[model samples]
Target chain A: MVDLNVFTTTTIYASVLALLSLGITLIYMTTRVFNFAHPRLSLVAAYAAATFMAIYARSAHLKPNLEPAETSIGYVTVPFPASFYLVGVVAATVFGVVAALVEYYAILKPLLRRGADYLKLMIATLAYDFILMAVLFLYNTHRAVKSALSNPLRLTPTSLSMTAYDVSIVTEGGTFIAGMFIFSAALAVALAAALYLLLYRTTLGVKMRASIENPPLAEVLGINVERIYAIAWILSGATAGLAGYIMLFATSAGSLKPISATSPADEIVVSAFAGSIVGGVNSIFGSIAGGLLIGYAETYVTQLLQAITGYPEMFQYARVVSMAIVALTLLFAPSGLAGLLRSPRARRLLSRIPVPGRARGGGR
Target chain B: MEEPIIVVDKVNAGYEKLQTLFDVSLEIPRGKITVIVGPNGAGKSTLLKTLFGLTKVYSGRITFEGRDITRLPPHERAKLGMAFIFQLNNVFAELTVKENLRLAGHDLPASVLEERIREVFETFPRLRERLDQKAGTMSGGERQMLAMAIGMIRKPKVFLIDEPTAGLAPKLAREVLENVRKLNEQGYTIVLVEQNVKAGLEIGDKGVLVVSGRIAFDGPAAELLARKDLAKMYLGIS
Candidate 1:
């Protein structure tokens, strides 16, 4: 029996990957044009974390970084011991919001104002990606040594390590399959639930959905589609920031090279696009499902291939396999996994079943 | 009695490079039903939509209630007490009729919203039977009525109805026309555009016959009816 430990590890990594992918999946679905700059937005967010770390390093006495709590799995413990986790979250969130505004002003707004070709906007994003990547490289290098405009980044190592149970989700014999399945599926399901509630259970979600469906129609109804778009961009930015942190944790890195260098976006942008498609791009729950499904397929498919074909090199080809799945899915199920999963009858049935406990978002 | 309820002076509007309305100018009386009747593509709907601030008015001036609203957004126009009932008459198809009414009547007193909806429903008992029904599932005739009722929920100063009787069977069309007449009599400044000349003239207090983006006849409904040749030339009828 092959040890499923690798699958367990990959599954955890995949869960975090799914969240990052969700953002890519989401904006792509609404705008329908691939935003090459999204992951770079992740890169930009890494800069934000760098800034946070810089500040934390400067502000001594309060343990600058949280020790990786061995028992904590789904969340990060603030390295600083001052018990100001909320402040750290806010600090990180503000950086995300700022980056979002920058993209909105620089890229999305001008294109929307002129009603520029979406394809052209997407193409223009390439230049922005290159620019940001160069900026990050310069910034990271300066942080490593010294730089102008930005105060030199300072990293002081702290001593707080989490145990195996804290960081690692160990899969033992016999119970490995069930344990790993529940763990992986749980993240995707929880994420899907939260996203569903946010998109369906909030007025902002209704307006956002309305804008996505028909911008001009929403405008006619007195909903400010332009403002909605800005908010959506900012929200997307915040989520991208979370995704950046997720990537940082997965690799256990404080130095922003793989992330800040723009490879973070490029690396998993395909997976995000794939996950988004696996879920209906428009449906919030759909994106999460898409992410989870891609995560499973990417991990399991590679393992399965490795198991069947005594070939070691096939593991490296997993991304290509993932991309191919996305391409094939797009070609056939263009509406995406949501399209395949949600037939009209299914929607009607779901509609009839009034959800319990949670508010209907029906309140005026 | 007062300044014209709505003013359009030398308005030129259309898609890029192709002008649909050419210096289309008209004055609509306050507190009266003003109907614009024309053949297909006479810019009847376009004129009303431009006045409602849908399509951009390239070179023209429009004033509503002593305020120059030449370049206001659709929602801003709504805030200025203006409303439009589209020909398609799409209510938020995803939402229920009640929710649709609630969104429209958001500007109203919170305490009386339910009572107001009930009163409006009593006016058209058809809606009373199906308050919770989704607008998408309703018949076209019922949809038009609900749409009209929705427009009134906000108590607009000037309500522009674009082809309310469109795509309905004759009996349903008559029902819708009667409802429009009833609403007008209930003290709403109504500007209507319709291709159904006879039905439009019947409900309309004043009718203007438009030809090729310009008004050819602007007078009482009876006068337009008596001058059959003028109506024929403008609307291509015998």
Candidate 2:
């Protein structure tokens, strides 16, 4: 039997998944275009961190003790913890902005001007998805792994769940999977709130909403719909990129093999997709909820499959269970948990179907 | 007068070579109710889109407020104080009526926006009651009202309403018309395209009839409405 602590762990994992899922949904609602490459943006963020850390490890300017020499690979490099992470964050943020522009200039801007429907724009995204995956895999391949942490995260191990990715430089702490998850979760909440404020409280956000809601009408009223779409893409993608970096710390994310090489991030992409679609694929919160729900399900079912069948190979079951749940959710609740929560009748019916830890409210 | 708020000079436009508007030229007076009445497919909406920068202008220039805004984007024109309400109900169905109005404010300062909202609520009290209700749930009349409120919230230099009374009961249509008149009287210029010939001519300062992508008739509203040919052929009286 799985311990109660395991369920708690699953809930935590689900919350982390919710972050990127929310981004996907937010971008979708605003532009009415699915950025299938959103998960890849997260991958980009992870690599950004890794690359920054890699460079910081051994710069003669940063650390005079380390002699910069040419290695068999090419350039001799030392890892610096402090500088690398900073560079990674900046790089990832920049990449996110660039990605948004690419989307705007290449697909959305033109499609929007032409008045393309949401579904048609999605086709372009599907194509862009493959191209992004290929490019990210190619880019990540240029890096080498380092076990020595010159600069590391400054947080409690319990808070971050530090992994032993590096033992040589023990003084510098690496943020463990747990830390990454927590950081990402906090960031997601902050981001969602900020975005809500921007859209609902600010004029720029309203302009964006107006443009999306009624383009021809808004244009007549002298609102710059094109500018709104462009800005929305850039800001939204930056978050997606940050989420990518968080995914790396939590798991073996950002491993891509090009030209017949397989990438581990491909697998992570599956869960992210499930989270997005499960959450109605249209709402930002729905995506986040979908992510966390799937994350917990994955962690929960994997344990069950392992315990009952004595199977160490339970990854497939985790995915399958998540998929099954997703399918049921789709069929029963196309609007997702949000939709169900919206209707009083549905809430009443759901209260009748009891689940543990769920309080049966009066359904008022 | 006042350099004509909007001027479309010799413009040709089409939908992929299937020409919709041809060599159309017109001037809209500031703060006046200009109505374009025509039979179906007379390119009334097309001309509006051309003027609003929604369609391609093959030959002539469209100027708004003395600026050659022919090639300017629709949203840019909105920034220049122009608003268009489509023939179909164009309110954000998923949003509340108030939410839709707020979106129209488009970066207005918070205090000013709040004041504007209050004033608009006073103007269209029906919207006040359903501020939080989703626009989709409202009746056809209500949806049109929401759209009109969205347009009026910005207090644009010129507002083009396509078939304003479309899909409404006679009572509701008259009510919507009254709202348009009230707004026009408040110093907002309006360009209305309507099917109700008698009522349109009676209210509008001038009536322009578009025929086969060209202006077939243009004159005072009463003069056009009084013509037997326009009444029988354009008004579909048979």
Candidate 3:
């Protein structure tokens, strides 16, 4: 019997990971900056989305379905409104764009103007990541304390209002999954298609490609290189935020309750980085494909290990499989798997075979 | 002689405190090709860079059509009817020929961009056949043509090209020089930096020969070509 649950879960994870890798690829390609703060930006968006969900619940005057345990302050719960998911996503995306633009203009731009080397800029991103992580911890603690939940960890909230919401869908094949799983996966594919069209079919997209390939040439050709970088940051951040919101909604059922304030960032960034590097850091499609490959491999490897050991605890080390993928890809394929497809040998093979009818060159 | 389209006067510049040009100056006449020929390490490329504001100009004045633009950035200079085609990495290697042309004519309206692309294709007819092909995959001669086509799409009044015919076969070199002369016929001021002394001077109206970062000679191209002594002394050409 095939386990449809593993397949569904793998797709969910792949969609989230791919969304994240796309942002990473875009930021790295245009600015050549390894943004450690990328995942932190997603965390911030997740919190912002949760907060909007809370606000929407309050404004609608909904009452909690389940009463909370007695605490210093009474349990304040608002029944979940499933449609508010859209509001949360929009809010998260907006918040992400604002944060990214601020970082670019206020921090990154100044450093670039001061002639900071790439190494310094990369270190600066690491420092900024720490600062954002601290902020997230503080925000999570604040929310927990105000809601009368125990805040002993002083990190992410102990439990979120989303725990009370249940949004699973039942299929005829006895497969169970959240409605959001489908929505998020569709959203990820749609975003990829949109990006492809923007890159190939628009004038601004052509200029962006030009800027990436050669900034000096683009500048002399009348392209505003700084402006292009700024736009790239905005797009990357917004995509990250959307990914975070979707992940939160899918996992928490239209709400967010991070296991730990700092852990969310580390997990997302690590997975996305592995995916991007394995796929091809420079190519958006490659990163997405990498994400999906890692997702499926991780799930299968864990299942195989558990079947062998007959111990569910073995599944905890599934992340080691992702690490292995990263290490192997870096060692054998420095340019990533996409590079192999674009290698000269592949091109030669592709070019050698002619069509069944007509002559070569195809009348072009 | 035509009025100066661009003048670099008393310019002292270099890269990061290593001064490569010492009080270098030249007048690029309108509608004429001015070739700057020099031996290796004679700062021929530096002079062109100084004019484009790519070098650190410690002190000097660059007037373009009578406007002082010494401290202007390269993009601003380009916007002011000036275009530069670098000696290397001049084209976006990953972009297709049509995409490269679109980027060069980014400032034009969609309708005007199509017309400009058509003009470039007419000038470099070979490029039209490879509109969808990546520039990096093109042959050396074809890449040179694509590079020149990129600069031409801008329709600049003054074009600063460095080593346009470098690393090409003899026939291709002559063909590139022919294209440069044809561009000059269209009333564009050209400042060419070249190693091929005979070919560059043959088509040029004026020439500046630099040796050891200083102008050893600046005069009519015919005079410089006729003076074999100056050629052997500075340009190392017979």
Question: Pick by lDDT: which candidate is best?
Answer: 3
Which one wins by DockQ: 1 or 3?
3
What does DockQ come to for candidate 3?
Answer: 0.54
**RMSD per model, one decimal:** 5.3, 7.8, 5.7
Worst 10 residues of 1 chain A by lDDT: A156-165
Rank list by lDDT = 3, 2, 1
Q: Could you give candidate 2's per-residue lDDT for residues A1-364 as a string of tens digits?
A: 6453354345445654676666676677667776666666655555555555445544524432233334443333233344544575677677766776786688766886687888888887766767776775555443232222233333121112123222112112321223343455577677768878987777776676667667666666666666766676777677666755554444432221211112334555577777887887766667777887788778766777787899888755677877788788878888787776668997678768868754533222
Preferred candidate (TM-score higher): 2 or 3: 3
| Fnat per model, in the order shown | 0.25, 0.80, 0.55
lDDT of 3 by residue, A1-364 (tens): 5576656656777777777787888888987888888877877787777676666656665444444333333333323455666677788899888777777787777897667878988888888888887877787777444453322111125333332343454444545665556776787788879888988788888888888889888887777787888888889889888876765644532112243566556765777888888888988788888877876777787778888889977756767888899999989988886897789998778668776753544444
Q: Runs in model 2 with CA error above 4 Å?
A: A1-16, A60-84, A111-120, A133-177, A252-262, A305-312, A346-364, B15-18, B129-134
Sorted by DockQ (best first), the order is 3, 2, 1
Q: List-wise, what DockQ does each model earn?
A: 0.35, 0.50, 0.54
* DockQ class, candidate 1: acceptable
Q: Candidate 2, residues B144-201: lDDT per residue as tens digits?
A: 8788788877778898888889778899899888888988988999999988867777
Model 1 segments beyond 4 Å from truth? Answer: A1-17, A24-33, A61-79, A82-88, A143-198, A252-257, A344-364, B107-109
Every model's TM-score: 0.83, 0.81, 0.86
Tell me chain A's TM-score in each of the predictions. Answer: 0.76, 0.70, 0.84
Kindly list the per-residue Cα lDDT of model 3 for residues B53-150, writing each as its tens digit: 78788898989999998888787888898898888899999988888888888888889889999988888889989987889989888888888888
User: Which candidate wins on DockQ?
Assistant: 3
**Which lDDT tens digits does candidate 1 get at residues A230-266?**
7766666776665554444344211112344655566
Looking at model 2 chain A, which ten-residue stretch has the lowest summed lDDT? A253-262
